[model samples]
Target: MYYHWIDTEKPAWAVTEIRERSRRAWNSLFAEERREKAEAEEKAEQERELKEYYAEQHRFFEEMGKKNREEARRMEEQERQRKEAREAERQRKKERARQAKATEEAGDGKGKYPRWTQ
Candidate 1:
């Protein structure tokens, strides 16, 4: 009795189709990995830019604060000088009035000159 075996050879078209499917699957996986990597890089760059922006804003406010303090100090110094000048003027006016009163009270010849000359 002879035994019959089934044919096990694959067709040429079937082998080419299998190879094409495998190539497509590997290409899809590689594309997905590249996309994920790009997204991660973009997120990191955005975070770095945000941090830099905040730092710049902080530095600007600090500079503004320092400038305001210096301006206030300068204004205070100017006011103090003005007050000193006003006080000096008042004192000078009082001294001049006192000297005038003293000169008027004393007669012209009797104050600083001899009476014989008049």
Candidate 2:
């Protein structure tokens, strides 16, 4: 029997022909289902790749954060050292001023002369 493509809504003339064609259509549908399944799997794989990429970025930022903390600590130490040095210098200047004033207040006398002069 000749099959007409335009009238696919009607069944084929023979029962055997109808069954065979139905089986073929079912097989095609199954193939389409498998293709869709594969596409979904591929999409899932792509999402996983993106997730991994972000995770790596997160790790990199964490490392940078540690480095930043170290740098801040070093800067604090340097600041502390500078403040201590300045404080010591200030104390030394004050001590020198006090000693000079005391010398000026004390009058020079022949009795205060060195033992060699005596």
Candidate 3:
């Protein structure tokens, strides 16, 4: 027995013509018995690959997050050091000014250089 399937490439043939070929595309690739098995296997393989890929991305993202956190911490420490250095510079300048004022006052004292009484 043979069945007629809509095959534009092959056109319509007699029942005997279809049977003589021995292999009907519909029977081999589209039969209810075999179709589900092939489709299910292909679907399962694709789904497994997709799941593995997502897992890989998650791991990669976790690693990146750790690296980013470490980088942020390092940058924060550097900024703190820079602020401390700036504060030390200001303190040194203030000390230098105070020393200059004291030296001027001391030099103005004595018989040769006496302080003016006001």
Candidate 4:
């Protein structure tokens, strides 16, 4: 039987065209939505990777800071030890001068003042 346009039915040819066009439009819309979703997922993944990278960098700096502080403390201790050693040497020299002065006073008349006539 030949297909015909009827009062209650669409023509076969027109129905086919309408169905094909509707399917194409629906497929294109679906493709666009899929592309948008993929792009969004990629952006979220990039942001997560960036956050992890920054956290690692911050940890590295924190470790460096700890090492620097330890080095500075060691240097300060060395400087303090050197200063104490110098102070001890100065005190020893002062003690020797005092002993020499006492000895000279006890030697009294053994030698006259070089600039005077006794």
The backbone clash count of each candidate, in order, is: 0, 0, 0, 0
Candidate 3 residue 87 Cα shift, in angstroms, is 0.8
The top-ranked prediction according to lDDT is: 1
TM-score of each: 0.74, 0.63, 0.61, 0.70
lDDT of 3 by residue, 78-103 (tens): 99999999999999999988887777
List candidate 4 segments past 4 Å from native. 1-5, 8-13, 107-118
Root-mean-square deviation per candidate: 6.3, 7.3, 10.8, 6.0
Kindly give the stretch of ten consecutive residues in candidate 1 with the minimal lDDT sum. Answer: 109-118
lDDT of 4 by residue, 13-63 (tens): 999999999999999999999999999999999999999999999999999
- What's the TM for model 1? 0.74
Task: Give the Å error, residue 62, model 1.
Answer: 0.5
Question: Which scores better on TM-score, 2 or 3?
Answer: 2
Which pairs clash (backbone N, Cα, C closer than 3 Å) in model 2? none
**Which residue pairs collide in model 1, if any?**
none
The C-alpha stretches of model 1 lying farther than 4 A from their native spots are 1-8, 107-118
Ranking by TM-score: 1, 4, 2, 3
Error of 4 at 110 (Å): 5.9
Q: For candidate 2, give the lDDT of residue 105.
A: 64
Residue 46 miss distance in model 3 (angstroms): 1.3
